[model samples]
Target: MLKSTTPTMVEAGTKTKKKHRTFSLNAKDKYYALLFLGPSLLILSVFVFYPMLRTLYISMFLTNTLGKTTVFNGLGNYTDLLGSPEYIASLGSTLVYVFAVTILTVGIGLLLANLASKRLPGIGVFRTLYSVTMGVSVSVAAIFWLFIFNPSTGFFALLSNMVGLPVINWLTDPTMAMWAVIITTVWMNLGFTFLILLGAISSVPTTLYEAASIEGASERRQFFKITVPMISPTLFFVSTITLIEGFKSFGLIDLITKGGPTNSTNMLVYRIYKDAFYSGNYAQASSEAIILTVIIAFFTFLQFKFLEKRVNY
Candidate 1:
């Protein structure tokens, strides 16, 4: 009886010792976790958070071309921008550009993803070839499109003349310039969208499809009812990122259109650049920057609020 009671006490002590060790290890882990996060936190504060705060502060004042503060304008910059025709036109262009790019990218991505999901010989090669655009940098892609859209000697020019397709100045024409830019944007963003959707589609369990087939569900029904729900999260993520990308797109517009033919392609981000770098009105640029940030934030918040509910997980 004494021996048995002594063993029980020893076991209890061991358990208490284990618990203490675990608690100590957890504390050490937390410390190390923070230590690991320190570099990232420092970088974000210095680069991202600091710039945002500075932009806000700068927006409240009028500044010279050299970015020196000239006068305290308070909200004058904002009001002036709202009333300016150029600003209004920029706003309209931005809206149209964002909507077009977002719709085209997601739609094309879904279509390509579905096609790539098929089990065919050499399908992997095809998928890889199709996703090659993802490796091209925005500047490079813009250059490629520029060559294609060049009015004098581009492929489109040759083809249009050959086929009697009624060639117009793709980059310089105000009416068609935005469409050209939109087409370029959609092509440049296509690979990323395709790859994301492909991964999401592949990750879906085959068992679900089999179960659906057993219930006499058609392929279209299976895709819409089963595949979509399983991959709704990826869809939501892609849409949100693409929306932000559309808003922040400056490289393509700068290279291809430069907000040309009466500023037809003048997006908000490009507008900020034009004001700051070209016009030397850094304060007004900062104001537009803040407004763009707010607009992107509002849309992102809306997506999370309404769309996240439909995401299965």
Candidate 2:
């Protein structure tokens, strides 16, 4: 009886010791994780978190040219903006611009990706040319388009002359100015989107296409049935990114249209810029900035909630 009891006690003590060791290891790992994450957290706190909070605070007050708050108006800036026709028009234009750019960019990108994915001679050269715009800076691209849009001596002018068409004002006319910027933006964004979609299309298993061919599947049928489904996840990601980028677009608008011939191309970002810097209305800009952030966040949430369900992987 004594031998049996003593062995049982020793086994229980060993189990307790093992548990203690495991707990210590887990605690040490947690400390190391926190140590590694500390710097990133600090940077985000300083740059992202603090500014977000500051913007929220500033949006509730009227600020001077230097951005110093002088009067607390708690939502007044928001109400005024909502009631203003100019602001409303700007918001509507921004929405139209974002949707147009996103749709055209993604559509054209997918088409180019599909074309480039074909196994043909000199395909590499075509691929290089398709993605070359990604290497160009936004300013440079804007300048290039500026020359192309020139009414008198640009490429469009020469094309018009060849076709016996009148040289249209690409940038000066209000209606045409918006389309001009949209076309430039689409061209600029095409390279990145094309590359992403091309990579996605390339990763799809060739076995599926071979199997489809065995079943007498046409190219269009195989593409819709296999390629699109296989790359749906990547497509979703690219669309989301493009949509957000379209919303945040400012530099191109600034360099090209300067908000436009009559504010027809004045997007939300440009409006915020004009309000803050040019108009010296920091409070209004802060409010507009916050609204834009909320709009982006809301759309992102909707995409994740609804659109993500369709992703294959």
Cα lDDT of model 2 by residue, 157-219, tens digit: 899999999998999998889999999999999999999999999999999999999999999
Q: Write the per-residue lDDT of candidate 1 for residues 100-142, one digit (tens) a residue.
A: 9998998899888988999999999979976889999988988
**Model 1, residue 310: C-alpha shift (Å):** 1.3
Q: Could you tally the backbone clashes for each prediction?
A: 0, 0
lDDT at 160, model 1: 94
Clashing pairs in 1: none
Error of 1 at 279 (Å): 1.1
What's the TM-score of every candidate structure?
A: 0.86, 0.90
At residue 144, what lDDT does model 1 achieve? 89
Which regions in candidate 1 have their CA more than 4 angstroms from the true location?
1-38
Candidate 2, which segments miss by more than 4 Å at Cα?
A: 1-30
